[model samples]
Target: MPFFKKKEPKKTKEQLEKEEEDKKAEEEKKILENEKQIEVAYRFLMQPEVQKFSDINKRVFLRKRGLTTDQIDQAFKRRDEKKESAQTGTEQQQITQQEQKASEENKSVLVYSETLEQKLATALKNGFLSIQKSNTTELSPKIFEVSNLKTLVASQNMLKEIPDAIGNLVNLRVVQLAECGLTNDVISDKLFSLPNLVELNLSKNKLTSIHLIVNLPELQRLDISYNNIVELPEDIEKCQKLQLMNIQNNYINFFPHNFTKLVNLKRILISGNQFEKEAEDALKSTGVEGLFKFLSQ
Candidate 1:
């Protein structure tokens, strides 16, 4: 009898290719993970507080976290490039939207020619009274006249100004216009004419002044963050009913000299601005009441 050794079966080409594909997918996932880490590191380093550190200290700190100088530099470069592309894309989109809006405004002449209440009902039905995401198609002019409209959320629109007709909505209670791309001089003073306006949010706009909303006696909450405001509006304390106010992330160098007059304010955020050391310390203390106490002194 002849002794025969069993032969091992070889893997087919298809099997080898599948293994290679799996390995490549895993490597890509890992690369993406590293890229996310680099983005987080970039944001951390770019903070105003972190930037106060010396360059040598920054390098030491980053190295301790396992990041290299080359990686940081590359991250910044990529961020700048992305910003440039995004800005370009935004400009193009804005131009296209403006043209589209103009065309729709002409059609709206017919759509909005009905009675004011009918127009208001139609606009509300067509998504005119809310904060719409960018994925929503073809934003039309959201003009309407409903006396009973209690809440209006018109955020993330390309509005250069709030229309004057909004003043007719006397029963409006809550109005949110965050990220509406409003300019300093764009908003008409008519917006402040709403007799029952209670909550107003204008965060993440381009407003350089806020004098219009100073006398809203029933305003309970007001958010005006991430704007270009250099100073608080005069007579802001006249909003005697205000409870919460957020004016963070602006260019304000100091709190209003008479900030203590706002005694009814329960919460106030003034971070990410150019505050003096004393003011900053006061804010960093126990709470909003402590900041008010410090301002009083």
Candidate 2:
């Protein structure tokens, strides 16, 4: 006798339709739940008590309440949209007036909390400011208020870009932004236009080229070591007062012939760069002076 094979029962058309309806219902429920969460997060963020918290702290608060980063961001986006939608022309003028008043108030403050504003305030008062390893990503516009700043050392920070407002500090004599994660594009040409800048150190950065060294009649010492520079600007000869330079550990193959015009240059460091055999030998045998003489001849 042959055995009969068992066959599974198939669902009715109505049953299949019911399953699809259940899936659609579940998706709608999830969407509603997400919208509710976003609404709650936005309300919590806009509460009078929560309004005083920083944006970073506000995100932390939402995360603590079990909202994911995407949910928190969505809530903030909604809040910003609402704000923009509700803002009238009168409100805009009021906000602008308030900002102007705040700017004026900032100039008179002598002491500030440990923020970039504090650094600018200190620079305003003392003409020198140094901020290192502070995780600073950007400079505050308040920096422009510190017009009397003479020395600014913001090394070892996370500032990948330098703002053009820094050029307003025309009194700057020393600027050291080494290890600040700078690139070629972020450097301002107005930085090179500082008439009083004497010492500039941009070492250990990711720069490929720097702006022309022009209008810096008082510039003396320059350091741009440990970068990806392929060539130096020919206008570097304009820094007639340059006394010392350090361009070590870069991709440079040769110096511009105009480099020989730097009559005041006394010391230079050119190691760990790509130079021709004769230039390398000259530098090894007789130092930067011999290399300069050889390149000149």
Candidate 3:
């Protein structure tokens, strides 16, 4: 018996036209975005703040200003050529000096950045911020005695999860993982193992719960802002040294019951959450102290 293969459904002319129109619209949107970025690059190149930075920092500043590497190079090249033209009659030896002087004078400058990942690699080699991933199939569990490491930032990567072995870096003081698409389930609970973690920023992630962080003894600053958090750990007061906590723009409806006990808190950015009307009104009127007092009652 012969078996017949299923035929694929063909798209209609109208559907094809619609797809083309959608593609064109998307391309136009991207072009507009690029044009805006180019304008921003030009403005950023003219900023007085850009004048003080070294070549590497200039590249970083450009990247932060939303300019693509290609745009940055093009801008820098144009600025350099303009300088070369201005000093046409200068001696060849003086030409180099003139170029250097003009390059420093203008707001435009450029140098290559390998990638954020590559920058992280250099930071790792220097023994402060380490990035260790082997392949897509499996991650390497190589632990480091990075006792003196002050900060570890792993942001805007395809990282599904941080390895459990990160806890081995016991002396880590600050950890930033903003905009990494991390969820609570993906992150290892061993993060709390870092006893010396004074600052922890997990902003712009998909975290639904972060009660595990309350165990960090020396945590002074916690930024779980812009997440899916609805409540904090009841024992949040355990972080006796916490001086600042930024939980703004989350799903939190109320402050923790023992929140008042955190007398060390100097700043608590809890706006843009699902707070109750009475509490929110009190907070909006009298501030954090009022909010704490209302919660305490």
- Name the top TM-score candidate: 2
lDDT of each: 0.68, 0.77, 0.69
What would you estimate as the lDDT of candidate 2?
0.77
Residue-by-residue lDDT tens digits, candidate 1, 1-297: 999998878989999999999999999998888888788777765665343334433434454467755665555556457556431112334434544674576643322222222334543445335544332222334343444567777677667567677777777888888887878677778778778888999999998888878767888899999999898865777887889989999999867666678878888888888877677777678567788777777
What's model 3's lDDT at 174?
A: 85
Error of 1 at 134 (Å): 6.3
Arranged by TM-score with the best first, the candidates are 2, 1, 3
Summarize candidate 2's per-residue lDDT along 12-44 as a digit string, tens digits.
999999999999999999999999999999887
Least accurate 10 contiguous residues by lDDT in model 1: 109-118
Query: How well does candidate 2 match the true structure in TM-score terms?
Result: 0.60
Q: What is the C-alpha RMSD of each candidate to the true structure, in Å?
A: 20.6, 15.3, 20.5
Residue range with the least summed lDDT across 10 consecutive positions in model 2 = 107-116
Off by over 4 Å in 1: 1-128, 134-143
lDDT of 3: 0.69
Task: Tell me the number of clashing residue pairs for each predicted model.
Answer: 0, 0, 0
Tell me the tens digit of each residue's lDDT in model 3 across 106-177: 423222122333343444456465332221212223224444556876655446777787778777888887
